[model samples]
Target: MGVHSVNWEPFLTCAVTGAGDTLSKHPDLPVTPEQIATAAIEAAEAGAAIVHIHVREPATGKGCREVAYYREVVERIRDSGVEVLINLTTGMGGDVVVGDRGGEDTPAPGSDFVGAMERLVHVEQLRPDLCSLDCGSLNFDDDRLVYVMPPAYLRPSAARIRELGVKPEMEVFDLGHVAFASRLVAEGLVEPPALFQLCLGISYGAPSTPAAMVAMRDHLPEGAVWSAFGLGRMEMPMVAQAMLLGGNLRVGLEDNLWLRRGVLASNADLVRRAKAIVEDLGGRLASPKEAADRLGLPPA
Candidate 1:
């Protein structure tokens, strides 16, 4: 035989800008609605099956809970004809921060505030095909963000997501989160062929290593549609790792800052790089429609 090639087609998602430490870190992090939409549309054109988004105020670059911001971003994306699955993050309200001594008495500023329904309100209104529902809570990084998702909270969040006809893309940060997600499926809260995002390399949670990815992948619900991401340097490596383990991949300025060392990156650039890696490994890129079908979402 002269030449034969293996075909491995995996969907790619571009997480535009995450809701963490981006304020002072990157000068070009998309903060305005126009910026977010432009970046997302460009990423779609660059071969992102999905555009995972988190909205921040243009003036402050700080994470905002205003539903209007989400509305503007979603509307812009829809009008732009990018043909990419929209995956807005519902992982916002789950943040919990405890106060200093005797501070439990005093509610920590902006900690553990919004309820489950409130968290999914934007998703309900915007009706993005998919939204991230963080499976559980964990101690976040030096940012001192305490990510908290109690069962009491997640149950309602899942129910709300179902009611709105929006898919809950369960975010599994650790092994326990995987178990919790399965329980949600068992409880009939989350629908069949559950969608999941295996978040790795974030501090104090699962390490971004092959062993960790395998463990989490094995624990996921059978036939579950899943994507994986590694933060910082391991972000792109985990894309290939997730593919080897038979899963999809996600990348963007959210998880990583550089196209290479000392060079700032863009959402489109991340997707382009991810495309090259997947293709080099003999994996084909999935289109937005294909990705939507794979994840049981309404096609773009």
Candidate 2:
């Protein structure tokens, strides 16, 4: 279906905090579990139907894969009585840093590569309504840092997520990732009416542009639900582009740190701004209930 032919009630997703080391870049970035949960609640109140989450180390403000942190954040959001859908990140535990010239077998201090089952520990424990599954590996913004998500790893991870009854939001960074995701759908690994998130404008991924967004949208499986977002300045532009192209929207400090030049933004600020753009364009924002139905998620 072409962009205009598809339905266009935009559902906003506030990616509350990502695994990126942006603590130093922005003073208001949520680090601790309490902070992250508060930001998520505020974003939902500001018009986001879904909140993408990543837990960080409270001490150092670095992203870490700990179930305790995830539990705390999820509990807080649930206890707060917000209606937003929780989408946790399973994209961590895949960082692989190659050592210097002499240390071929030895990985760097930051390298963390574990099995598929180990990576999904938090998802299994918390059982969020949605969780992210990176479709393929790529040079994660730097040559030395590789994000490893081989097909062998993805098959089992997708299966496990399905078994846990959590919808996997397949994260596609490039055309090849989309193809692989299609394979997962074909193999019956991913649930029917597969969902995707087209991630653009990282260091070595697809360029963030209207043409690139359209091309990637075209590559998705038939009737698949998808959302797209870009990094840095392209964040808001892609928000509008995704809505125009018959998909949902995602915005947060995870993708872009600033609302404008010299202005650091909170997740709520980004969602509020995106809500305005969607409304001014004659597109209505989806509520949490509406979003769950559109994305094939069970009632919250």
TM of each candidate vs. truth: 0.94, 0.97
- The deviation in Å at residue 91 for candidate 1 is 1.4
- Report the number of the highest-lDDT candidate: 2
**Residues 1-300, model 1: lDDT tens digits:** 122223278888899988886769889999998899999999999999888889897788977667898899999999986698898998777776666754654346766557778888788878898899998889886645688789999998899888888888899899999999999998999997798899999888899999998889888776677889999889889988888888889999999988999998999999999899998897789998888777677678
Worst 10 residues of 1 by lDDT: 1-10
For every candidate in turn, the CA RMSD to the true structure comes to 3.7, 1.3
lDDT of 2 by residue, 1-300 (tens): 554543358888899889888999998899999999999999999999999999999999999999999999999999999899999999989998887763765478788888889999999999999999999999986658989999889999999999999999999999999999989999999987798999999888888999998989898888898999999999999988998888899999999999899989999999989999888788888999998998788766
Q: After superposition, how far is residue 34 of candidate 1 from its true place, in Å?
A: 0.5
In angstroms, how far off is 23's CA in candidate 2?
0.5
What's the TM for model 1?
Answer: 0.94
Give the C-alpha miss distance for residue 300 in model 1, angstroms. Answer: 0.8
- Global CA lDDT of candidate 1, please? 0.86
